[model samples]
Target: MPHTTVLPFKALLLDMDGTLVNSDAVVERCWREWALEHGLDPAEALKVVHGRQGYATMAVLLPERPMELNHADNKVMLAKETADTEGVVPIGGAPAFMAAVADLPHALVTSADEKLAQARMGAAALPMPATRVTAELVGASKPDPEGFLKGAAELGFDPADCIVFEDSGAGIEAGKAAGMRVLGVGPRAAEHAPTAVVADLTQVRVVTDADGSTSLHVTV
Candidate 1:
């Protein structure tokens, strides 16, 4: 099949979880286990956990508990997640798509801490970018525009000139708030107000410009 031609953008901002890696099962499992252990509702827990940092999600779910306890449990859950990375898959075409843009200006913006992000990406065998804005790297998480803006800054590009590939509502909100165009990944992305939405990275194509620019053209 022919690759769709992406329009040129100054830089690319990528979301780590559902966008680049299929770690949803692992995430759901860990959170469900954590919710059960904490006497929280699993469905409610999943709703709160989907796009936020683990510690932050815990705080929301268990507000009465001490922050330290939440942190400890978060660590335990993260450890379990790290050890249980068995069925991780790269989102379709992610490996080659990443390779196609490897040399370009790009950065990963994720709610996961650097450790978890690295561990998950390592398990998926996805190439890590030099610039990444992780949970620990930002004082605030997505929907706040902090991480996305920071990523654009780290890539030395203005937010208006960057394009973001994201899968979650929070990520899309962040990108939009940061003044960047967003391409939503995965089926549920319609809920997020994205400039475009596709099933996976496989539906996206990298288009190069004569001026040495690149853009992600999506098929869905």
Candidate 2:
């Protein structure tokens, strides 16, 4: 076992897509298609799409379009995504890492709705947490902190007492805004403003104490 430094925390908040499941290709493809359909710029669309809910992304990219249209496009994209879920992969060390903390107090906070999150998790064969704050449950998405705050609230832990695992700029922003320490995962995660950035979950270890406090010990 690796030497671990246990920090004091009450709960864990996790980001679903990139942090847990590698759905980058799926997300990029969907956004590109939506952008083409709306005659919008793909590059610009990508900026708004990453780490945001489908409806929210569409709304930003196609602001001139009606909310109904955005919602409809989101439905179509989600349906296609949910059915064609073959490429989804679990992030490195995600399975074992999740297993290590399965019994602890944790909740998922994601820009995806419950249905889409469940679909992706199922495709990736990743375990889902009992408590989750999905897009449908929150008024705003990441970079706004609503989802993470809601997740912390649902987990019954103070924001400062929670640690968040995230893989995107928006998710990291939300975690920090919620007053939680954040661990960044994946390639571009370092630029997301997390307290620490690691290549994958394999580099991270969580230590729990008898008093139900937790600390994340990350290698690298």
Cα RMSD, each candidate: 2.2, 2.4
**For candidate 2, which ten residues in a row score worst on lDDT?**
1-10
Candidate 2 lDDT, 75-164, residue by residue in tens: 788887776676889999999988988998999888887888899999889999999988779887678888888888888889998988
> Which portions of model 1 show Cα errors greater than 4 Å?
1-6, 64-66
State, as a TM-score between 0 and 1, how close model 1 is to the true structure. 0.91
Model 1 root-mean-square deviation: 2.2
Q: Estimate each model's TM-score.
A: 0.91, 0.91
Q: How does each model score on lDDT?
A: 0.84, 0.83
Summarize candidate 1's per-residue lDDT along 77-153 as a digit string, tens digits: 77787778877889999999889889989998998878888988998899999999988788876778999999998
Question: C-alpha displacement of 195 in model 2, angstroms?
Answer: 0.9
